[model samples]
Target: MSEVQVVRGEMQPWTDRTSPRPALAALLTDVVPANRRTLILGPHAPQLIESVLAHSADVTILVRSVADAQQLGEDFGPCLQVIAGALDGLQTPPYDVVIASDGLDRVLGYDSADLSWSERLAAVAALAAPDAVVVLGLENEFSLLNLLDSRPAAERHGDDEWRPLHDDPSRPVSVEQLRTALPWTAEVYADFASRTYVRADVAANARPGEFPTRLAVAALEQTDVPLLSPAHEGVDTAARAGLLGSIPTGWLAVIGAQPSHDIYTETADTVLTADQNLTGWDTTISGEPVPATELSFDPGVVPATVSAGVSVESVLFRLASAEDVPGFRKLAADLGDWVTESRVVLRWDDVVYDGESFAHGVSGWVTEEPVEKEDLLAAAWVRFHERLVGQHRRHPWPPWMLGDDLVSAWLGMSGVEAPEQTPATSPDTPPATSEQVARGKEIARALDEVLGTATGTVDVRTALAEAEAAKHELFELKGHVYGLERTLGFRNKAMKTRENRIRELRGQLQKVTAAHERIRGSRTYAVSRVIFHAAQVRKPKVVARKISRKIDRKIRKR
Candidate 1:
């Protein structure tokens, strides 16, 4: 078995926070079966682990960090076994479900000298029962976005040891590569931001119905720009040009045979997960199962009732025919534009239909975030106005039908008071009196003159004073800046002068020390020193006579 680190006590409280990177929690819930023996290869995410535990499934997590394993063990009690080791060391009875949320190539130590990537994949396959499902997550190195970003923003900082693990030759497998690696053919899904996954073919087709990430949509709205970066523009262009599969950010490959799971039927209302309502049939419409995206509100075509003061994430509108699909898309787009303009957000999931106009067929609009009913009502009014105005231009509706009462009712739903205005008459209607026409023309000329000039121009004197004050402030700031520079220059010169003086003193001191060393080492000095020492040893008078005789000899020679 590989090295093990065991953690077996209480851990710090697990406070939930939003994950900055895309999370696979929602996708895991959809794919993994309930009440089964499941094994997770990595426990990097506590929320994902907790979400799996919520399904009443027996789960085992294999983690590299003992502390993380210990925390998982502590937070989840005996039900969850947090093993601290590599995948190679894991030994257990065959599991019904195995999930490698942290890419398969990474867990295997692809570049390690001990094990090859293929061997690691085989080792993981051995852990799965014959009928068990295995899910593997992988990054797309060739993702079109990857081309735009050679080095990710996250990795620009120095610590990048993890990059090699992901970029190893064994990883970021293509669909064909995945087929070759796994024993059984798998269903490969390409994902956006690791959250939005679609069938490989569907993604590659780049249909108009494709939904973008909420963050992406929100960013576009903020900039009031479409496709700001090359990466952003690449995705849209690729999807439109049927090249999404060729360049996906990540892949979720489900290996082994897919098992049948029971559908949930407890609630009449169907809630969507990860921007998708996975339940094929709506329980609210009928107990019977219908293969449609929306519930069949048949037998009656009354407008769907949305309760006030309640926050909703999505609303379904049944379309009359497939011919209306394009028109419905237009309406959805218009609604999204209006919502964004209001600084609110609403995203389109897709437009789906099943033949019967009033029954199984429906078109859905999803909000990026849950919004109040009033906001939804305002969005609906915008949609209505677009539709009405468009039709009114080509084939006009009678004034009464498009009158104040109708507009007012729509506005009242959103707590807005509709502005009062005279109903517009048909263009073919009779002309007005000559006197009335003359008065209208005069009013038009006067209004044009007022608008032609700048109506809100400031007083010239006030503007001049403000500009003059700004100039004075600029000059004062420059003066202070100049004074600071002068002071710095003086200090620099003084420092240089002190350094030069120190250098000169050091030169003079070195010369004096050299001369003293030369005098002490001379042969004559050594002889004289010896004679004086000998004289001193004999008598103090003899030492004085020897020093005087040496000085006289030296003076005579000079």
Candidate 2:
């Protein structure tokens, strides 16, 4: 059985919580020399140790934690020699293959001398034979992941960061600096959490539709951190500007042995590798080839060459951001036609154009069931709407138009009406009822929650600013409404006063007309009218002569 050797300054009651990295294990399949003396400098995943053992029988692992060393000794039995001590205490022959993929930060124990990053790197190199292959992993302090991280400073710098020596001047920050610092020829890979690794130079020269760009984007999108911003957006922007390699989360440097593949990616069950030709990927599970039909999800199905062209979603983003309604509608119509003809339910981001026709860039998620064309279209558009709004992507659409309304508008633009009951079902099942559609949407939302795509926390500053603006707008609207109501009330009162006066005048005129008609209808008034007419008709001269004669006779008698 193997034995644990305790040297000077061993850390007690400590365990390195590093998890297994499948991509790193796959990389070791190519780096570890067969039957050669190998040394592992820090605590790594057990799977990686097993991989090293698979290649070389003579192996030794040095870890600062005594418990970890003892556990390693027990686990491997006679296959491994475990050393529990600080790096400075280890006294052994130079190894032909030295691997420090976990970095140098954890190699020094609490009781050991305070060493700078460069000094520790030099010590690791010193332990390597003249022609030894050294594999090193270095985390970047200024990586995009760290920049976009939304966690508090205290939470980010935990107990594990006791002596980070971040301000050391001799430490390498970039790939160029790292290459220059290494004594031997080395190949550097832009490592993304050990899930994906791409050649540094290739990633630096990536463009929007290229394989490197796609790989970088896919890797960045898999983050589960509460990011201040979307990681994929930053990756896309960096790739477009030809600066992707400059901001990788970490770097893996391999010296003495060259990697056969330019790219390495690890899924849950498989490792995918692509050579410089970039024609296709070679997929394996634990160094054994697996059939394509056995795989459930294949992330390595990106375009083989630049000729495959850009994704439809990319074009849609451009048009929507530019607020070119006409252009967006035209493209939507074309996409609708393609979907109708092909009857394939693929995501807009997965559908690419090859100058003449649309094609699926990734194929594993295509729907196998027969679904109505409109329903399929609605589902795709609805998903797009969710991502567009959830990611806070700018678009021409109004802010108030959301949920089904926004999805309907998008479907309308695509020359297909939105389904009344839209389903968000898996590719294998076709939705049949409204209940099913509702359940499907719920499942989709749940999936988003599981994936951490919907960050529940809003930016406190931005939310407060928006709330203040909305409150001010509502207050002004209320004041304007109050003024209009007051004016309307006064006008209504004046109109009622005029209406009452008109009614009073009409009553007085009716009384006067009744009195005149009564006088005209009375008998006395009729006789008086008859006498007046008689006097007018008689001769007034005869009456006056009779009166004068009578008056002259009276005067003679007197």
Candidate 3:
């Protein structure tokens, strides 16, 4: 369908149903899916029980519940609301038109909820009978709408790296929020607020005092009832009842740190002027009938006939805090449809605002370049590794792989070679020397790393040499330690024998220690990123045979 009709500003005697998205019903009529089962087929679908009731009833129905769905005179049709736990066997398809409305979107869009969006949708979808139509509604631009339309609001910015700003002072509940919060079309209860900011020194700081600086003959407005001008500041009790001096009207409320007025005031409602132009539009939130009880966004009324200059017309409700970055960014997104290039300014305390409006003097401050994402991940990884090493050094499994034997089986690092392996001992026997255990651990770590990074052709003899001396402890095959898990007889006895061998190793250790002394002295621990040779366990026998032949040839030559 073409865009629906849209209405703007205060209601004019002349009405235009001409536009595609009528500003009033823009969202409900077109935005939502008009399927058979709007909500059941989706969380947004209307209730089957309510849908059935609305289809055949002329009664002023009150489908009482959370965010009650009531049709006073049936201007449209039906509505529904199924609270989370109250949905007794919700899968039983009840309604033909299920409208999930905008509420479900809030659950899905931002925070982390128990059930994901799709999960919720699936539950609702399964409820549908065959061919049941499910229509779900979500505010595509949720945050933006509030900036341009909501009343009192707040937003947060630069609160923290993770949670910078929240509860923005600028973002107001949007007309949609109002519709969902209250029970009316946003336009029915509101007006497009146009104000020329009245700066004490400069031209209007915000707006509303756009035209007419002071009173000449104050514009008189009457809604059959006397419509007082909101501007004049004279203390005339006599004029107070019937005559309000020189204030232009058309503001519902104002909310800020030191608001010009109270949270709400009545003198802002639309009063008919002699010229028939809209004036003094004090918005009434709680259904107050009199101007005395009427609340406004700002406190004081505007004066009549002020100087006119650069004029700006914008959406009526902007209750968002200018300081809330995410919220305002959301609002900027909503208002983006109504305003030009939207942005959210966040103050990173001990930090600067980074922006791009320098040409307009609307630029920002930049203290430093933002941190990169990779740096964050790297930092997290290092911290995790350190924590694991600290807490699990004695574990036979490497701290890095965590519990994933498959993945841990392939982790590697540079700059470390296997230390010579000693032997292991059981508790029934004397505990093995710390030196022996340390050597085995070092070799194990090195072997794991080599497997993880090894490449190219296999070198057999070197592979056998690098194998652990405790190999028998893990293998049925002697002299070799395969990467397989769970060996049978090899563990206990082999470890004992290896321990015995190390005990007998006392004499050989001196020679080995002499070689180690020289080797340890020259140890430069620098890593060479060279490709290591792959180990082919079987080929060691072949290579050994060739070595023996070369040795015999060398002996004959000698």
Candidate 4:
């Protein structure tokens, strides 16, 4: 909106293949406060900092080193604040919005060379203003195996590589024990983002040089530690309201799933041109609901399905549990798709890495007699639960019965339409109550003081109290959430059973309708033609045949 421009250093995507930073900047315009101190984390080019400047006045860019900061400052003088030091302990100026542009992904795992990505991110979030917004972006570039390749060759097996353990500062990991390693790191950032900063905004910036006029951005970063993602008043509105969300002290996370790193520019343009009504408001330059290229009963296509030719066709997994009743249908795929400039809103729980396991299609599911189960997705889900619960040692949310995989699925489930623009929550949220109003006053006062406080970053009670008051409000929301859950739980069980019945009835009805239609349409088909020519035949006994033969002989002689 600020006279957007992209100085293509490279032969900018002749199409929609531009750097995502600009789109990211546009999305941040909605989340970042009008103007406050802002922090940019990691080794992004100065271009991202320019994006921050476009939205807010007071901005600071935090780099890995002071030298980089100085150099960056020279490039974009006076407007930049660079902190050159160890990321683990660097002091950051107070900021309202923090952008981590594909920077944290570098330190995601245990690397002896630097602090773990989680450590750096959590540390930065702690440095932010209590209610400040942090926008952490990770490129879909690295693979899960990159974390496992830390093992030294001599001590590894099965594509073994030297693996570093971030949590265990003194220990190293073996390759076979790789599955356990990836989540611990993924979990850490997942936890830190959940804790330090509530996702206030989630958006996809465009691929640099892509879409000269319009860009494709997918946003899933919205948190609730006094954070929020506002549904804009008009359609195609990026993030608009709910300035904050609560990140309880114990644990929380923000997760996203990128189907592919290689996005199609031609496809995006085609879809963009096709969606004239949506271009103005609700639109996605590039998002294919189904994984584009399917495989030939390939187990690798769906690691969760594991066996050759054994797969899952479909299961009732959802994102928002409270999907409007009418919006959901047993026969239709009506789930919501967030495709606007900044539409896809995601929580910390939606993140899944390559190692976690997913199937591109439900291949290998058909057998002589297919093994159909109520929760067909459960077998693979066991590993998912183990990862979230056993591997990461995180809380088993969404009721204990729903393992990590299902819970993760629900965590990522989306709606048929973008969530309606509303206040962070309704007046029904805790701040509405008398006690809550008092607590809110307390929290705001504390927040004001904490931002100005010189020391006491971790020990800051005002921030913690504000977190607590909001948590209490969340507690109230949790109650209603659970109440809706109880009602939905009953509905889900009923629906599962109902789906089975509907399937059987539909099968039977299809058979009956096909048989009846076939018979009605076939010209040769008739009740009297049971034997094909039965109507032309008359009963003929052996004795009658003999008498008729003799009479025919006498008649012939006469």
Best by TM-score: 2
Give the clash count for each candidate. Answer: 0, 0, 108, 61
Off by over 4 Å in 1: 1-23, 54-57, 105-116, 150-164, 209-230, 257-558
Best by lDDT: 2
Say what the RMSD of model 4 is.
28.2
Candidate 4 local lDDT, 452-525, one digit each (tens): 22121221233455588789989999999999999999999999999999999999999999998898777666
Local accuracy by lDDT, each model? 0.48, 0.74, 0.26, 0.34
| Candidate 1 lDDT for residue 469 | 75
Candidate 1: lDDT over CA atoms? 0.48
TM-score of each: 0.45, 0.73, 0.19, 0.28
Model 1: lDDT of residue 51: 64
**Candidate 4 regions with alpha-carbon error over 4 angstroms:** 1-20, 103-114, 138-281, 284-558
Give the per-residue lDDT of model 3 (tens digit) for 346-376.
1111011112111111012111233232222
Q: Which residue pairs come into collision in candidate 1?
A: none
Q: What lDDT score goes with residue 231 in model 4?
A: 15
Displacement of residue 407 (Cα, Å) in model 4 is: 46
Candidate 2 residues 93-200, lDDT tens each? Answer: 799999999888788888888778888988898899999999998988778888878787567767754445656788788999999988888999999866789989
Off by over 4 Å in 3: 1-89, 105-113, 129-134, 139-558
